[model samples]
Target: MTQPSPHPTLTPQFCFSTVALRDFLRISRASIDDSITQNLNALYTPAGQGFDPSSTSVRAPRPQNSRQIAPSSCRAFKDQVLFPSWQVRSDVLNYCASVATSPDPDDPESVLRQVESERDRERVVNERLDPYSARFFPREARTEMLAAVVRQERSVEKIIRARSWGLVGERCGGDFREWEEAMNEWRKAREK
Candidate 1:
């Protein structure tokens, strides 16, 4: 006869059900959806009003005699704006997908970290869109906008600067290089 088990809870008696798995996935998806909505809402002011175009607080003085620059050629727009923005967005989405599907998806702390990472990635997208902003904005307005960006970045510097390379192995599916490269891309974009 077999001896009594020391760790009965570790036995194979526990059952897995498709219903449970489906419920878990549904909840996770809802949580992610809420997070996306919250982030989008955070872009607006507390009063629910967006920046005022008529307000000169952030606007640059326009030269009375300045002529409007012609719109970018199709090739220039594709090369300079569309493709680069798409690549950055694609990289971020791919990174998030890898992390979400990692082995420890059940860990709550890891989930929080992933959420913070997504926010940082969103900021990178904002910075990447700066060139697109330049298409219609004045030089001084661009400078002021960048300064605001820098200020906001400083507020989140601690979170952004924290890099746990050890966790990257588990988070990135046993390879940290992909995560490192993606993070470097974010940093490089911010530098510009």
Candidate 2:
């Protein structure tokens, strides 16, 4: 009859849920998540294997760096930072997101420029409201914050960077909801 479907394990949605799809596409989970449509195209019509998902293809290209591993469009939310003007840079804190294990070429000589003018700081800058560092934070929000901070630029205000750094370090800690509240306040004030 139907030859019992050669591959019993594969399912329409399983591929999407599993890492195999990424390995097949030669991209990272972040890359796939960043642009599912693009990755799907690549998966269905792979540059390798002559457009045959069944056929084996050349090994996926290895990324030289973490960022390259994922498409640039991928937003690292946890890595993102919110500034006084409210600009999103997505690349400013790439390495600073974590404690540097090794010397980084991208490290800023000084974050002195990140501070705001006296009036601006006083008007817009809010003190770290949460006096106690959080013992635990949900994983999802942390991940989102990383992406959000990564988009920020070097010229960003220090207070914003401080908050982000604190969050990442889990020191000046809170959850995404708290962050949203603060950001919304800053955003609304700026708009008016």
Candidate 3:
């Protein structure tokens, strides 16, 4: 048989218009699930040795720093195992629900207003259960609650602006400042 060429030939860039992006996304999700399952299995059974984080004990020499680090490290592990799946599932369900119940795409202003209204309602509920008002409503309860609501509302508004700017930048390939200006214009129009 003839000897193979010493150097392999490089293939030219072929246009791949046949593949749908959704197919790639599905493949990626499958691969991620497989990897996560593999990792979980390895973590659960190290060389066929059953190991549980809750039952595991660290026998390191007690150090002054151990007290501070131990609780936080345990918390980190607990958070990783408990929160990730719940967050992913909740996000997927929320996205599906939003899509199923989405309002008219042409009415972005109405959607924004609805979001703000929902936020305000949440603020009202949160204010009623404010931690600071636990014992009993003092003389300044109304003033304090009003101030807390305003502060919380401002924080929520800031979060909304940041998220909106991120979406605007992604969709329009523009800076956040441009988004902020557009937001201001929208606010003025809404005020009218």
Candidate 4:
């Protein structure tokens, strides 16, 4: 028996179509970007672990004695800096809130002016941040905005909790409504 000619050989086919070329270019660009990001992350992080320079336990960098030898030894050293995007966003938001709430001595004019200036700074920051950060955390997206969203969500949650508490009040020993009533009675007695 020929034994199916030793299991039919498979040959690869190359497509040089315009679609294929476009796809290839796209894939190549993506891979290049990903590799650059990884290298950047590597510089900030240790092998197989995330690293943050701001953290207390800063790792001692390798001493570079020679160009060839040092590079081979300390392969983890990447040139890119992995700035904390979330922290920046949180800080910007905090600044905006502080400026809005707390009156400054310098600008006795409308607090709106201060806010507008802060918004301008925010825009500058948004422009300066890398593509990934600009995409994820736009300068226009304030911390207060996120807080407002959270507050709204919490209100909805509180409503659900109120219903849930009503259901479980008796089972959990007493209703919150009864407790509130008792507290009101105590307050009235204290007032008298």
Candidate 5:
């Protein structure tokens, strides 16, 4: 009797031409991107205005250790760019703590979970400390926001395209719609 192979081999159920496979993949990616864009729009539209810093005027003290001398609104916007509010911070910290403490120390999956939790906790703490840091901004909006805030006049589209910064900057829920809304709010505030 023939011995069964130790490693399982995957057999293709159907043959696909290279072009067809590429097209399918392309369509799948586009569908996912569109869904994400739609969801972001729904979650952060006209009603979710409070979190936007550009829409309000405040004379709050400068954030600790920040060297930015930009307009107060801009500074305020940057301050709340990460995590949205204190509630998010608390929840994130608690979740990370739970993940770090509840797992078996010797299990590989548990070890990885602990390490990831520690890293996430550290990132959240760092973001809380310096939300204005460029590293916290999404790739698509980072340079554009910097340019606008610093009053630099230049086309950012070419740069964004060259860098291939995904069609919809979804990092940390940051997207073009949010960026556009923030920009419009800032412009209106500036005009006042």
Candidate 6:
């Protein structure tokens, strides 16, 4: 009978996609729409006479130069400025949704399992989009992988340094040629 093919060993791999990341954020935002609306309303009172509890008048503030003016400006500014801001936020939410739905290029398992928690996903996207923040993701995985390789190399070097055969003639109390021969034999045995 023919022998069955040997099973391949699994190795860790990094995978990510802009589309998947965006979709994840979108789904998370949709799940929390009510909460978001409430929070936005709390933070920015809608333009109306009773919008602001502190104001004696009934009108809401106007948006000027992208800043919300006091509760005394025209109501049109609120609709034009504040409402559009919310719309932009909603667009961002949609972008996130697209990302979450996209297929991962590196690791299919991670994409299927949604290994990145919703909060972490959000944080990563937010940080990435921030103008002042450094890009720490989408490339961090590769950076970390390279660092691990370097660390492993260093460890191997240390082991070689500690071996008696690795010592030079002055340290081994033998001829340089003898030490070299011993080291070569040691490497051959290790390979086997």
Alpha carbon lDDT of each predicted model: 0.34, 0.33, 0.35, 0.33, 0.33, 0.36
- Model 1 misses residue 23 by how many Å? 26
Model 2 segments beyond 4 Å from truth? Answer: 1-81, 90-169, 173-176
Which tens-of-lDDT digit does each residue in 1-192 have in candidate 5? 111112112112111122332243234333332243342333333343245575468667764423222244233432332112212222333333333344223333445555666765576435566776425322222223222422321132223222222323432223444443544464567569
Each prediction's RMSD over C-alphas, in Å, is: 28.8, 23.7, 23.2, 30.4, 25.5, 32.2
Of the candidates shown, which would achieve the greatest TM-score relative to the real structure? 3
Candidate 4 lDDT by residue in tens digits, 121-186: 676334455655434323322333434543443354345434433432322222346423533454
By summed lDDT, the worst window of 10 consecutive residues in model 2 runs over 1-10
Error of 3 at 28 (Å): 32
Q: Residue 140's C-alpha lDDT in candidate 5?
A: 26
Sequence-dependent TM-score of model 4? 0.21
Candidate 1 clash pair list: none
Model 1 Cα shift for residue 29 (angstroms): 21
lDDT of candidate 1 at residue 95, scale 0 to 100: 37
Candidate 1 residue 41 C-alpha distance from true site, Å:
28
Q: Across residues 1-192, which tens digit of lDDT does each residue of candidate 6 receive?
A: 111112222122211233343343344334333233332334343463345565655566754422232333222322333223333433443433343345436643444335444534665345556865544334233334334443443354334333422222222132345433544554466469
Residue pairs with colliding backbones in model 3 are none
In model 6, which runs have C-alpha deviations exceeding 4 angstroms?
Answer: 1-109, 112-130, 133-136, 139-147, 150-152, 155-168, 177-181, 186-192
lDDT: the better of candidates 3 and 5: 3
